[model samples]
Target: MPLGVGFASPAAGVLAATGALAALRAAGLGAAHSAVEVSVAQAALLTVGQYLAAATADEGAEDEGTEDEERAGPGGPPFTSLDGVRFELETLEADGWQRFWAALGADRRAAARAWRPFQLRYATAVCPLPADLAAATAALPYRHTAALSAECGPTATEVAARPAPESGRAVPWRLTPGGATAGAARPPGPGRGPLDGVTVVEVARRVQGPLAGHVLGLLGARVVRVEPPGGDPLRGVPPMAGPVSARFTALNRHKEVLEADLRSPAGRAAVRGAVAGADVLLHSLAPAKVPALGLDADALTAVRPGLVHVQASGSGAEHGPGLPLGTDYPVQAYSGLAALVTPPGEPVRPSLMTLCDVLGGLVCAQGAVAALEARERTGRAQRVESSLLSAAQLLCRLGGDGSAPSLPVCTDLAELAADPRLAPALERAGCTLVRPPWTFRP
Candidate 1:
């Protein structure tokens, strides 16, 4: 049985499914593992390896000016666009932080004024730090003096706070197996592939949850994507053919789509009916709405017995009391990704693509797969949760590899599909730039 729920981006779902497959292999339930997860892990390792290579280069050199220049590039105003447009700030070193603070305006200043030094430097958009200055302010409380030498201009207005600690041991995913007394039986279906007999009911919108379902479908699960009455809001996003969004098509290719509004009684019944037969139930609804929809882990598992329930959110369920309003962009800013990309004396430049959302989806998928494997062993249902914030933190932990080659950004997926680098994958998937990085051989 496989059930995964997620609420972030397509990437979370993809990763969660991959994670489930990995757990299955680890549990000796199958011989195959998720190629997607392996590919992602390799990429992350390569990045860290590059960082290590750079860090160890000419360690004994007193003045590594060449290396430093190569890492940061020739000192100039930070670039604001892919086309290399630069924004200039006319302020001396002494006035840099003051100008930045003043430019932030009153509300942003009030929110950021109390940040600790490391928090300010890592979390806020005050300014960029010179190498010596960054080293000096490493552990101190944020101070007006430190602000004076900050070189970056005002960017974001929101204050970044550390995520609250989990109240108890944080389980990445949950599993609940059917009791022997409850008549736990293997689902009736021919194994289609690695996830052959698994049936996933995806009651989620946007990228994260749906994407996970999509990956499961690729792996041979029968994934049903439940949408609200009219359809998912993402279906209307631009670059459409007819009424379908290309982005939507890219993320959701093989899954079955259903329309049911959870807000109505009939819709709720429809959803429950779908889940009743499903091995996995995945959703990305806000925590506050779960109980109302009768989709909460405890509620669903009570009826389904051994159902695997997964939830994807912007933040962990316990961290933010009300509805989680986070998305990839905000998570990136809060997680210090913006600062990493921004050059000195410039505004923060977020990646053009939704990096956190993608990663979050993959992680959610991984957790879901792991839970499925646990259920097979324990005959119990499992509750799994993932968030964009957590995904961002994981990405940051990978650190930087300044020595890696600079690759040009691909503006068009169609163009990328034609490139020799991706042509084989594109041909096999029968789609343009829509294949998962790894191949799945039966």
Candidate 2:
């Protein structure tokens, strides 16, 4: 994105405050050890480890290669209609996809050929849909397209052609204390770092959950990442920094790792053991997957009372499960953001930047920090939850009609990093890294 992708820039303040407070409070009270729980949902059906959803997914037929990236292609979606209307299409079911294309008069073979890339577009950042599909839309007006979407299967909406005037942003996160466990006092042992002596267990796949954990780790918490038995798939993504994916390292360089499959009994046992000894757990895996691992909130809090459990979902419960598949692009399409963030009368190009995912992480971190503070004060376990859905609403609210985004827009990550004002907050490298946004004092 052209802008700083800056919401997370402020997350540093929230984490810093809680970490420092925990350190000071622990020093005063004297304690040791802590327990934390993190849950993420990355099921294609709707959710995953919040951490992995925006990052590690390889849902397409194959990873779109670098060659695919440079191709002279329209790339995918937010497709334009025949009557001067640009629109976004969304559907969670393959049947819906098949139905939508058929209704548009696209050839069966071509629509089938397009599905893999369409599904994988978010991960690859490119979707080379067959020309037939594009031509189908071009031949018909947007109203026809919209009507077909309504009648056939997929949801379709006209992308806002102009930026709406800006006005506000919704609260980034929501926190609820589970009183499920008012069970333990804060651990003791005077420690350093704003959150010294605090421990955070992170089980995530991609950007959002991991970034939040990164902030927590920066605040001085002992952050442990739980990977599958094979380690993160992203570790192999190109542009390696040392031996791993530079992008992955940029977000996860400092954390410890524990490889285990939450799907296996041994892996579930391994996670339980880790959470028993940590102060907080932050993750974004699917809810359906949670109980299978025997790591649901009630079960885990049973193991260690007062553990802060944070779930970063694609969309919280408020939006219900029937919504489109929960991922960054779909959320952009569904949340009205694809249309809102563009310049007035410009094509609604949702910034390729991980906009809502980043904001989701920042807001989630703030919520996590607040939960930590509450845990310290009341000796009760707290539930902290946030979602890309909420972040989208928040941005739309804060952005107003979207005519003018507060931060100057930029499409290039490199250029955004190069700006003199943002340069200090970023690290120039193979993969840009956002530095801690605040400096803390004792």
Candidate 3:
């Protein structure tokens, strides 16, 4: 809490690879030049997009710094048990929240009072849960607490230590081909980007799926984002950029928006219309939701040959009910990332930053790009999947399962951009805008 996170360098490293992939695309296409550049400062800023939205967004009018932020307390999570085991707790539903607390003998009314704020922690960056919840956990040993969780509901993974040797060896993503005797991929059109001619229909929400689509869009792919008919609720969460939330703008500014209720027949038809000629179809729908909506991979790829279908999942959809719901925090806990970034001698915690989400997005983009390349080479790119679980494995492997080093403490985006340590990376040395993360010079 007192230091900046060690997220940017690794993310910039991924971007560098992305740039290299761009050059590879250029070379493969026999383009005249292939040059790419990525900036770490920019990558760091990208992580703060949502927070910046919360900060700069109008609350009737922009209120300056609030009271708690000035005081020194990272007042959120990674709660500790009386037995001295530290861990993060996660449960997607309110009923699960109630059950977990009930098993711990928490007051029913208090548990009910705590649920909304607890759920909003990620969005608001602070959770003012009733103190009773902590008191309940503090009274019990971790084993008791964990046993209750397993018996009833909610996931209570112990903050992990460095994983086994095999953790370091897992690939970030898996690419499965459609079939044999494939047609060669069509040449990308002259649209000024390595992926210019590619069209991607994106049906996703939150960071991972949208971020992947954002990366693809940055690479000059035509990205069409499908949202609910009323639009994503996060759009109105404040810190507006012109009309929409700055966080939304940061992730989605480059893509086209199509509002459709995927639960309806008309909505799926609309998405099918968009994907009719598209090269890629990406979604973050729940594992079963996609099939329920009649958009399963087998059906689509069968109908439209050579389509690169990427699913950004929380856990492997195939794993089914064995894993935590694929949100950023729980995945961090389940995947061992909470432990990797936890400071030595401190309780393990999921990062305030969406580390796995960002990395998952990058990995998804990487898979999509690789799939595109495979299609070009083998003429068949089929189903591709990236999960927060996989990202956590790769992150813990990349960062090691050991406790994380201390980082500079900058409370929010404003303070982060102004931190003197980041001066060299800043274009103006103090600008809110970090350098653009990627550059293509032809």
| Best-performing candidate as measured by TM-score | 3
lDDT for model 1 comes to 0.51
Better of 1 and 3 by lDDT: 3
lDDT of 3 by residue, 255-278 (tens): 888898887889988888787778
> Model 1 over residues 1-442: C-alpha lDDT tens digits?
1111111223333444564564354335544443434354332321122122222222211132233333432222222222322222222133444455443332333223322221222111223323332222332334332243244533321213222233223343333444322344343233234666777999876566766676666566788889877778766543443445445665676788779988799999888888888878888888788898888867776567777788878776546422223655556655555454444454554443456555666667777777776777666667788876666665555434433445565443344434676343443222232444434433
Best by lDDT: 3
> Count of backbone clashes for each model?
40, 63, 8
Model 2, 65: alpha-carbon shift in Å? 4.7
Model 3 pairs whose backbones collide: 3-407, 3-408, 3-409, 4-407, 4-408, 57-239, 162-401, 314-326
**Predicted structure 3: clash tally:** 8
- Displacement of residue 192 (Cα, Å) in model 3 is 2.2
List model 2 lDDT by residue over 62-133, tens digit each: 334445333425636777787877666777678989988888888887777777667655444556776777
Q: Rank the candidates by lDDT, best first.
A: 3, 2, 1
TM-score of each: 0.62, 0.72, 0.83
Off by over 4 Å in 2: 1-69, 80-131, 136-170, 180-191, 320-322, 400-432
Model 2 RMSD vs true structure: 7.8
Error of 3 at 272 (Å): 2.2
